[model samples]
Structure formats: structure tokens, C-alpha cells
Target: MLEIVLMHPDGKLQRLEAPVGVSLMQVATGAGVRSIVAECGGSAMCATCHVYVDPAWAGKLAPPLANELEMLECTSSERRPTSRLSCQIKLRADLDGLTVQLPESQQ
Candidate 1:
């Protein structure tokens, strides 16, 4: 299982244990975390699942692909160097302690 820590802007933190290989958006939605809209499921077609990857684990995951990059450009929130689309991030055993911060808004 991969353990993920998701933090909300209001200082709330949620810890979830998800099986490896699923997308981060899937795990967050399954846990009832509403920050990520995941409008297109895991298709990488929407940026509603945007999150900021913790700098500590940024290098552990794959760089964004062209599709994901394009989608992220549509997010309503300001993008940061660590910004990423949760749907494009797949969980792995090596990402057991992955941490991501939910953006202020997805509307």
C-alpha cells in the first residue's frame, strides 16, 4: 500500500492508504476528499484534480507529459513549480509517504 498525505488550505490533513498503481485522483476521491473535482475521472482531460506536490517527493515521480501540462494550464488556481494534476500521478510502493497540497479552489 502507498500512504498519501493530503493537506487542505485550512490546515486540515488527511492520511490515506491506497493500493499501489492507482492514480492519486482516484484515491483522493475514494476517500471523500472534495478538493479534487476529478471531472474527467483519470483521463487527464481536466485540471480540476490539480495539487501541489511536496518538494521533498517532487523528483520521485515522473515529469508531467504534454497532455497533463496542457490540462494544468486550465486550472483556476495559480500554478506553482510543484503543481501537478493528480490524475496523472500513479501511486507506487516507492511513493508510500507522498504528500500533496490541495489547491484553494477547483471551481
Candidate 2:
């Protein structure tokens, strides 16, 4: 299992242990993390699963694919250097302690 830490805008945090190979959206949504909406499931068609990758764990993840980058451009929130679509992040052993900050809004 891989551990993911999700931080809310108000500073609340949710720690989830998800099986490897699952998308971040799947774990977060299943855990009822209010930060993720996952409106399009894991299709990368919507920005509702947007999250800011913690700089400390940024290098641990793979670069975003073309489709994920395209979808992030449509997010209502400003995209930061750490911005990523949760649907595009898959859990892996190397990402055991992955940490992500929830965006202010997922509209």
C-alpha cells in the first residue's frame, strides 16, 4: 500500500493508505476526502480532481501527460508549478508518502 496525505485549504489533513496502482482520485474519493470532486471519474476530462503536489514529494512523481496538462488549463483556480490532476497520479511504492494540497476550489 501507498500512503497519501491530502491537506485541505483550512489546514485539515486526511491520510489514506491505498493499494498500489490505483489513481490518487480513486483513493481520495473513496476515503471521502472533501477536497476531491472527481466529476469525470479518472478520465482527466475535468479539473475537479486538481491538487497541488507538495514540493518535497514533487520529484517522486512522474510528469503529467499531455491530456492531464490540457485539462488542468481549464481549472477555475490558478495553476501553479505544482498543480496536477489527481486522476493522473497513480499510487506506487516509491510514492508511499506522497503529499498533496487541495485547491481552494474545484469548480
- Listed in order, each prediction's TM-score against the native is 0.97, 0.95
Q: lDDT tens string, model 2, 15-62?
A: 889999999999999988877899988999999999999999888899
Q: How far is 68's C-alpha from truth in model 1 (Å)?
A: 0.5
Candidate 2 regions exceeding 4 Å error are: none
Best by TM-score: 1
Per-residue lDDT tens digits for candidate 1, residues 1-107, read: 87999999997989999999999999999989989999888898889999999999999999999998888889879999999999999998999999999999987
Candidate 1 residue spans exceeding 4 A from truth: none
Q: In candidate 2, what residue range of length 10 has the lowest lDDT sum?
A: 32-41
